[model samples]
Target: MIFYGKQNVNKVDIEAVVSVLQSDFLTQGPAIEKFEQYVAKYCGAKYAVAVTNATSALHIACLAAGLKKGDILWTTPITFTASANCGRYCGADIDFVDIDKKTYNISVEELEEKLINTDVKPKVVVPVHFTGQSCDMEKMYRLAKQYNFKIIEDASHAIGGEYKGHKVGCCEFSDMVVFSFHPVKIVTTGEGGMVLTNNKDLYDKLILYRSHGITRNQDLMTKKSDGPWYYQQIDLGFNYRMTDIQAALGYSQMQRIDEFVTKRRYLVNRYNDLLKDLPLILPYQIDEANSSWHLYVVKIDFNKVNKAKVDIFKEMKNKGVCLNLHYIPVHTQPYYQSLGFKQGDFPNSEAYYKEVFTLPLYYDLSYEEQDYIVQCLKEVLE
Candidate 1:
């Protein structure tokens, strides 16, 4: 059956990991730094911290940003729970901004309105790059400056995407940017993530937060070192370090990022062209952002289509297609609802969740396979 997403791993990726296995250090070693440097340079950022996963990257980023109890952290409701859970990990109150109907990212207009009217402003606002398309970060950044809130871009779907001619992880528009390297993401490190930042202080904090908050550097220590072996646990942190094996694979994957993005974009165009006549709302592109097309999601106009959403999924599955939903609004989840986020809290996001679904789009998806997917979709809709 055709899956919604898949990783593209070549011989080079395998060889890189195999070589790291033969090396002296497998966890905290040269491979990690090398991979970090490559990602930083590619994204035009000053520093990149590799971690175990995107969730951990977001966790450390929130901690480094001084998110604590009673502070507010805001993100779009139409995202993976990890986007909101990261704030909860810091004991911060998690709130959600509604999504833009077209872009499916956080509604910048709503965010500014909320900022202007609310008594409590967010300590940090995480704008997710949904479906690899960046939100209107320039406007978001302007609002942030005016309101005195930090911006942490949850760019898990957008490693190679560009906004206003700058790379997404450049930190030109946000304080920090996070990337995921899961098997189904734009790149694969088996399972890894990275946080990129331009501020030296934030970079230092992220480094400390990723590895038990311990530091061997004498400058950061409270007292002078007793010996070369002396270290200090300066703050509470987690063991979120990325292993050399994962880093090596990530470095190799970095070499082919452009190729991967180009292939995905090509397939996205194909899907857009083939599915144009169907009763679906195709992905929309904003003029300022060039998406990486990590996911090719379309909204079914159920008013025009006779089938229920579940029945469409069932029919597609029976026909060997495995379509998937990108998200359910985070506020509607039981945990968030118990936190007092009830239905009708975010109308646009809840409306979006009912109609949108992801189509297969990945680096290795061939034209023939894509045509078959379109055919299956056409049959189901017809």
Candidate 2:
């Protein structure tokens, strides 16, 4: 069955990992630094810190941004829980900003309205780059400057994409940008993540927090070391370091990032051509942003289609097109509900959650497979 997403690994990726296995170190080694440097250089960021996964990357980035108890963190509710959970991990009160109905990224207009009316401004606003499309970050950046808030771009779905000619992780508009290297993402690190930043102090904090807050650097230590092995736990942190094996694979995968994004864009174009006449709302790309097309999500117009979203999903799956839902509204989750968020808090997110489903989208998906999936979708909708 065709899946919604899958990893594209070739002989080179395998060879990279195998060579790392033959080396002396498996966890912390030269590959890690090489991978970090490659990503930082590619994304045009001054520094990058590699971690175990995007969740850990978000955690460390939030901590580095000075998020703490009693501080409020805001993000779109239409993303994976990690985008919001990172703020919660720092003991910050998490809140949701609605998403744009078109791009499905965070809505800059709603964000402005929220910022203008609210008494207590958010300490950090995480604008998620949903489905590989960058948010209106320039506008968000303007708001951030006016309100004295930090911007943490949740760019988990956007690595090879660009916004207004700048690479998504360039940190041109945000204080920090987070990337995911999960199998389904643009590149695979076998479950790894990276945080990119332009600020030296935040970069240092991110590095410290990713590895149990321990610092071996003499410049950061309180006293001179008696031995070469001396270190200090500067603050509370977690074990979120990426393994060398993962880094080697990631470094190799980075070589094909452009190729992967190009293929996905080709598929998205084909899907748009084939599925335009169907009773569904196709994904939209903003004029200033180029999407990586990490997901090709379509919303079934329930009024036109005679089936519920679940029924259509089951039908497609049974027909060998294994589609998936991108997310449920984070605010409607039981955990968020307990936090005083309820069904009607964000109407747009709730509406989106009911109608949207991700189609087969990945680097290795072929034209024949895509045609089959489209045929199945047509049959399901019919």
Candidate 3:
């Protein structure tokens, strides 16, 4: 069956890993820094700290931003729990802002309204770049400056995407941008993530926490520290380092970054062309941003469709069109409900969760597979 997303790996990817295995440095070495530099330069960020996964990267990034108990963090309700869980990992009180129906991203207008009436203002606003389309960064940044809150862009789905001509990870309009290089993402490091930032202070903090808060820098070492080889634990931290093997894989994948994004866009265009008039509402990419098209989600019109959404999904699956759901409203989950978030707290997110389904979207999904999926969708809906 055609899965919703799949990784595009070739000889180059495997060869890169083999080369790393043949080398002396397998964990901490030149390859890691090489991959980091490649990503930093590509995204126009001053620094990129590689971690084991995006969740770890998010954790370190939030901690570096000074999030802690009593501090509030806000994010969109319609996203992977990792977006909000990162805040909770730092003991920050998590809150949700509803999503806009069109882009399925955090609504800037709703965010502004919430801020106007909020009692304890958020210390950080983590706007998720859902489906590789950016949130309203201009409006969000202006509000962040006014409200004295930091911005952590949850760009896990948008490494190669762009907003207003700037690359998503540039961090020009936010405190930092986080990326996930999972198997399904545009670039793959098997299971890895990176945190990009322009601020040296935040960069230093991220680096600090990423590797057990240990520092060998003489400037940061204890005043009476022993020898040149001595190190000190400056603060609380974690073991979130990415290995040289993963970095080598990431570095190789970086070469095809543009190719991967271009192929996904082509596939999305094909799907749109074939199914735009069908019994569904296709994803809407913002005109101001160049979306990476990480997901091709469509909302089924239950009233017009012949069968129940579940039956339609099952039929598609049987036909080898492995459709999936992009998300469930995080606030509606059992854990979030226990946190006091009820069913109707975010109307748009709840509505989105009810009807949306993800179609096959990835670089390796060929034109033939897309055609088959579209034909199967048409058959199922009819």
Candidate 4:
């Protein structure tokens, strides 16, 4: 069966994990720092803090940005719930701006319109880079400066993507950026995440937030805390620290990120050519930006054919092709519905959800397998 996403593990990756298992420090160790340094250097960011997963990274980012109860946090509805749930973790009110039909990212025009007219001032904006395509960061940065809102880029699908010819996590256009290291990402650490930022204060806060807020910082204590054995819980935090074993795998995976991204791009080009003549709409490129091609999503022509998305989905599954949907609109979730969100609020997101399906596109997917997938899709569609 062809999977929509997968990890490319090698003997070297296995050996890296084995070495970590035989090492002295398993949790908080030098390997974790090494992994953080590797990602930070790759992204050209000043600091990178490793966490248990991308959700935890997002949570810390929101907390460090001072999101609190009654504060508004805005993002695109077409993303994983973690994108908006992180704000709710900090007790902040969460809302969403509709997405652009072409880019599948938040619309800057809609964002500006909401900010200009809404009674509730937003404390932060978390723009998700869906399918590894970056949002319009320069425009978002300008809006941030004007509206006095912070930015936490949920770059879970975009660690290797470039914005304006620079790494996405350099924070050139946002306050902070978060990355995922799940097995299906560009690189794998089993399960891990990182937070990148240039501001030292936010960096320090991220460190504290990842580990129960218990800090040994001498300067942060209320009183002159004791020597060599001083620590305090300044604010509430979580046990979100990443393990050294996971970090070791991440460090090894970092070496091949460029190669992985290159291969994904090649495969996407192949798909674009093979499926161009089909009754489907292909994903449009984000202008002037380089994507990592995390998922190859195409919109089926439900209007052209009598077959709805569900029929095609069931046929693909029955044929042993594990094609998957990227996501449903986060605002439509039952949990979010209690927050007063209703259908028809974000038409573009709903439309994307109805027709979009991710094809089998991963680093390890072979050329022959792809041809078979295309052939099968043609048989099903035609």
* CA deviation > 4 Å runs, candidate 1: none
Worst 10 residues of 3 by lDDT: 216-225
Give lDDT tens digits, candidate 1, residues 34-81.
999999999999999999999999999999999999999999998899
Q: Point out where model 3 deviates above 4 Å.
A: none
Ranking by TM-score: 1, 2, 3, 4
TM-score of each: 0.99, 0.99, 0.98, 0.98
Error of 2 at 289 (Å): 0.3
Backbone atom clashes (below 3 Å) for every candidate: 0, 0, 0, 0
- Which candidate has the top score in lDDT? 1
**lDDT by residue (tens digit), candidate 2, 1-382:** 8988999999999999999999999998899999999999999999999999999999999999999999999999999999999999999999999999898888999999999999999999999999999998999999999999999999999999999998999999999999999999989998999999999999999989998999999999999998987999989989999999999999999999999999999999999999999998999889999998889899988888888887887888788888899889899889989999999999999889989999989988989999898888888888
Write model 4 residue lDDT over 187-287, tens digit each, in one string.
Answer: 88889899999999999999999999989888778888877877899989899999989998999889999999999999999999999988889999877
* Per-model CA lDDT versus the true structure: 0.94, 0.93, 0.91, 0.91
lDDT, candidate 3, 55-126, per-residue tens: 999999999999999999999988899999999999989999999999999999999999999878999999
How many angstroms is residue 347 displaced in model 1 relative to the true structure, after the best TM-score fit? 0.5
Cα RMSD, model 4: 1.0
In terms of lDDT, model 2 sits at 0.93
Candidate 3 local distance difference test against the native: 0.91
